[model samples]
Target: MDKLEGKLHKLEFYISLLLQMVDDTKYPFFKLVIENQLSEEEVTEVIELCKQTEIDFYVQKEQGWVIYEDLLAQFVGQLNSKLPVNQVIKSLYDQEMYSELMGEFLSIIAKHN
Candidate 1:
């Protein structure tokens, strides 16, 4: 089933991300991701998948990456069902940093399940 495969792919993508940096020594595990030594301990398999793109981009470009505009738009549309996610997403949108490394995340999901 396409849906099942898609979900699996998503899980795989997140896993790849978590296997990277699993520890940050700055933030106290309750603050923004920026205030610390980048790590992945706090990230979950699901959330990690969403951040795969960012991880890859940082390695390849040494710069931040953004998800495709169309994809980001679609994600936002889907986020409407969750008010809390929508709020955070909106904040990122306002900052023009909405992609937040999601492109690599999608790419990883498309790779292997």
Candidate 2:
């Protein structure tokens, strides 16, 4: 099932990307589970789990460098919400701060995994 496989791929991709952000941020551990035979419903459930586990950590921004702990916490909170994937992504992408950090984190994730 391409549709289901695609969703899994997307979830895996997002989990990996989010993990990358978490690794660099203050919250060392966050709830991120990668499922093999996941339906859309299950993926959303995992997202909700992640949201509740999100912690508000401090961050500092200086020049071109940003601490990103606060941004990562916000990202996790958004990630775990019950919102539709497209809607959640749209909101996240619209916010330039998270969007840019996500891009960098995704790039870093690609290299590592």
Instruction: Using lDDT, give the best candidate's number.
Output: 2
- For candidate 1, lDDT tens digit of each residue in 1-113? 99999999998687657645544332223223333223454334324434553454555555543435444444445432323443334333333342544433335445544
Cα lDDT tens digits for candidate 2, 17-70: 866665323332122222233456766665454333222212233334445444
What value of lDDT does candidate 1 attain over all alpha carbons?
0.43
Q: Give Cα distance to truth, residue 25, candidate 2, Å.
A: 5.2
Candidate 2, superposed: residue stretches over 4 Å from native: 23-25, 31-113
Q: Global lDDT of each model?
A: 0.43, 0.45
Worst 10 residues of 2 by lDDT: 26-35
Q: How much is 93 displaced in model 1, in angstroms?
A: 8.5
CA lDDT of 30 in candidate 2? 25
TM-score of 1: 0.24
